[model samples]
Structure formats: structure tokens, C-alpha cells
Target: MELKSFKFDLDERQVKWIFSPLRDKIQVIELLMKIIKIILVDDKLDSERIKGKVVLRVSKMSRLFFFSEDKFFSINFPFLVFHANKDLSFQSKNGNKVDNKVTSDVLGLLASEVLLSSDHVLEFADPVADIEDYNSGFWSLLKELLLFEDGYIRYDYDDKHVNGQRHPLNHLDIFYCSGSTFKIGLRQRITDNHLMDLLDLETDSHFLERL
Candidate 1:
């Protein structure tokens, strides 16, 4: 589903505040749209699971807002992919023993490229790893787009910390919303730390477009 298809509710007061001093809001949305485009064109999902999907667009412009009754269920996205980069090594959530024979994992592939039709595709588990500063993997680029301060990526997990468990630091923080089907743009409120952090970085590097 496109941005215009969803029914959106706006807070005029918040809308004005969000649009005034903030910049890069469009850049953030554009990045999200790129991710969504990959998802829409990718043929890695099961057909039965991809049906009955809806896209909800919020009217706010702080950080990109993505939510769904089911994880990645909106816009007919297939199962969500959970990944972790630990000890500078790449692996899936299940702690699949990464042998030199296996090079690319789900998270790495999704972040790097999107395949419309291929031999293998990324699959999603359930729940996800705990929230941690995930600034070490492909998710780091995405996390930077989501929050100005710092955050971790989270997708799916079983939470059965038994033997042979894989814990990834970088993950996406998208989850399920079991509630009424309504549209609400969601973005984190900017903070002094966020502004100062960006200012400090501005003196050295231009990670994003000037707003």
C-alpha cells in the first residue's frame, strides 16, 4: 500500500511544531519508503502470509513511524527478518554456527539488497532480542535514521534462552500492535541530546542532508 491509501489522523498543533524547527524529516521518510519499496518488490514472502495487508500512514514528521497489527504484516510484507552482529561476526538470531562456507545472513542481505525472485530469502521468527545500542551492523544505518540519540534493531525472538541461543546486538524495533485499525503517524520527540549530538557531528562529517 502507498502512503495515500491509509486513513490518517493529524494533530494540527503537533503538526506545526514538528514541521517548524526540524529538518531531514523528508529524508527519513524517503529512506523508509526505500525500505518499503524493497519489501513490496521482493518475492521472499509466502503468498498466504502476504495477503490481507494494510498500510497505515501517520501525519507526524519526527522520526519515521512503522507499526502493524502483525509484524511486517502491513503492505503485504512477508515474515520479518531478525539479525544480530556480535563480536564483529555476522549470524542469524538462532545462533546458527557461522561457518566460512556461509557468507551472507538474512539481515545482511536485506540491508544490502532486495531480491524479487531468488533461491533463498530472509525468514522471520517471533518476539526479538532485547533493546541494546545496535550501532555495529547494517542495522546501524537504519537505527541512525530512526533515532537521533542511539537505539538498537529488533525483529523476532522466541525468548527461550536455552542452550545454543544466538544474541545479536543490532536489530530493528518494530513489533505487533493488537488494537483497532487506525492510522497514527509515530515519531520520537526530539531532545536536546539529539540536537547537540547532530551539531557535534556536523563539525566533522555530513551523515545526512542539511535540513
Candidate 2:
């Protein structure tokens, strides 16, 4: 007796809906890039250029790390995987080529969770300063900041695990708190537009007048 084999291919529409998480992730990446660009261009921020060609990187588990060159600051996507059934096509894949289209999601959801953490201090390096001195004052401030004794914005998202009045799915953990109980819950998940708006707000407090 001979056995028959078959392979099924997904159409464009199916590919999109099925892998929407990945698509969302790609969009998130794009949004992050835009924010970074805005920061770099703003003369007030005086953002320091990443020392190497790589400003962002993905680990084997799909978590993303940005501004790796700087020890005190970074943006992390610790849980952006969306796996389902038995699909492991993108398993352990660590590259920036997840999609080719401007907003592509060719790779369907490849994990079971999605989270984002935007961690950074208000201070940036002096653009004209030598590379070696990039972390000068910022590092010292970061040390104190690490103890939750300073002010900073840390946007975090988590939908994987939720409990009543505890770990809200969407919340902003402003300033570093020693305990995780301090959280400001939001009614909806944060979007690229929200982040963009935040960037504008941070850049120019006057922007609020326009809104």
C-alpha cells in the first residue's frame, strides 16, 4: 500500500489573519524606528548615535533589544512570540527580515505571548562628545534611577497572563518601583499611534496646545 502526501499553502488573506501578531510586531518595529529617528533628529534630545551598525537585535527566542551599545538604556520586546498548533517555521529565527513589504506579516503568529518595554532615561549624550564619554553622566544617573529613586517613563504591555486587580493587560510603570504592584492600568492596548503621540509630547510640551 502506498501513502499519499499533501502540502497546503495559505493564501494572502489567510496569511495575514493567521499571522496578524507577527504583522503587529512588524508594525511595532516600524513605529519604534520612527520614534528613534525623531529622537535622533531633535536637537533638544541630543541623542547619541549607536556606536555600531546595529541599533537593534533579535535573540533566538524572538525577544528584541534596542540600543545595545548603551548599557544604561534600552527598549525591550521580551514576549512578542505567537505560536500556534504545530507551526515552528520561524522558531528560533533571529533576524530583521521577518517581512519585506512596508507592513508585512508573511510569517504568521509564531508564539503565544506579546509584550513590550520602552526603557530609557531623559538624558542623552552630547553629540559632539567623544564616543568613549557617551555614557559619562548618564551612567551615574542611571544607577540611582535603577533604585527607583528617579523619574523615567517605562511603557510596558502584557496580555499573556492576567489576574484580577493585579497584573492588568495594559499598563504604564512610570518610574522604577521596587514592587510590581504600582501600575497605572489602561482600558486598551497601546498602539503605534499612542507611542508616536508620546514621542511628540516628550519632544515639545507645546504640542499639547495643538491637540
Candidate 3:
């Protein structure tokens, strides 16, 4: 498999949703990268390694109850896996511990699950099918995979030496699959902040009222 790595910065406007309110107020600029490893495996599977700032945005809003007023709560912020060849970026408010390694691991698990449940090829080759169902299905599955565990994943950090110098590293070796299956493996690290922030944001609001 050929893995291509590319890095970029995040846009400043989306930083507020990622960092905690108690965090430092200084400007945090983070560089986000995506390492897409393409392989012609049994079912045309592509493993993606996404590394970047863990800023999340609540793109949609839902009501608390079936007939309740429309509230700004009950939002879903799927992990944004920026394509290595795309022109998207993110900037942080406080640039402390802005390492992509941690975030990459989180995304690796997400990517794995998404690929596992996604349909690689369609039976019909209709152009309209690609536009409507194919694209929507892919994104829907991706979002479910990211928010599968309600962002309850864990990480372990360790110190390593390279060229006689010690460096800090984060590893995401454990995760819950389908909010049921538990799996542990050594893979690239991705931050859990993105998932945690989503949960925090969601739980703060009354979502059932909007549903």
C-alpha cells in the first residue's frame, strides 16, 4: 500500500468549538494532515490516517421533543477528515500540545470502522445513484462510525527517544466498536478531544425535546 502524507493548518473561525472555555485564551494554530493509504485489497479498501487539530463544529440542530421549539442543541459534529489533497484548514486559540500524532490514532479507528461497514462497490452503475444514495450513504456511515461510541475512546501517552533525544508520543490502542465490540491494537495516534468535545456539547443540551 502507498501511504501519502500531507499537512495543513485549520481555519481560525472553527477553533472556538474545539477548545474548552477554561483553556488559555491565546491564539492556537494547529497543522492538520491526512495520510491516505490506498490499496487494491479484496474489496478496494483505503486506509486513511488523519492528523490535525481536534476542533469540532456542530453543523446541525434538532428539537428537544417531537413538537418542541427548535433549539440550537442536539447537534452532531462528525470528525472532519480533511483530504490530504484538499484545501481545507483549521487554527487553534491556544497552541499547547498541538500534535497531530494523537489525533491520527483516533481517526484511524474511525476510518477502519467506516471502511468495514461501507459498500465498496455498487451493483448498478447509474450516475444518479452515485449522486444521491452512494454519496449520502458513505457520509451517513462515516458519521455513525465517528460518533459510534459517543466519543468515549481512550488514549495512552508515552515518551520515546529518537537520535538520543526523548520525545512525547500519544497512542490510541483501545476502542469500542459499534458501541459494543471492544478491540485493542497498536496503530497511528489520533486525539480523543474531538470525540470528547462532541459528547460534552451534546449532553449539555436537551436533545430529546427536539427529537
- How close is every model to the real structure, measured as TM-score? 0.19, 0.27, 0.19
> Distance from true position, residue 161, model 3, in Å?
28
Say which candidate scores most in lDDT. Answer: 2
Residues 79-105, candidate 1: write the lDDT tens digits. 122223311122333333222222223
lDDT of 2 by residue, 23-129 (tens): 23344444433333332332232134223121222233122222211111123422233324532122112222211221121111111123123232212222212
The regions of model 2 sitting more than 4 angstroms off are 1-151, 179-181, 202-211
Model 1 TM-score relative to the real fold: 0.19
lDDT of 1: 0.28
Structure candidate 2, residue pairs in collision: 19-108, 19-109, 81-111, 82-110, 82-111, 83-110, 83-111
Ranking the candidates on lDDT from highest down gives 2, 1, 3
TM-score of 2: 0.27
Query: What is the Cα-based lDDT of residue 50 in candidate 3?
Result: 23
Q: Give the clashing residue pairs of candidate 1, or none.
A: 58-185, 84-168, 126-157, 127-157, 128-156, 128-157, 153-171, 153-172, 154-171, 154-172
The order by descending TM-score is: 2, 3, 1
Q: Note the clash tally of each candidate.
A: 10, 7, 26
User: Candidate 3: where are CA atoms >4 Å away?
Assistant: 18-211
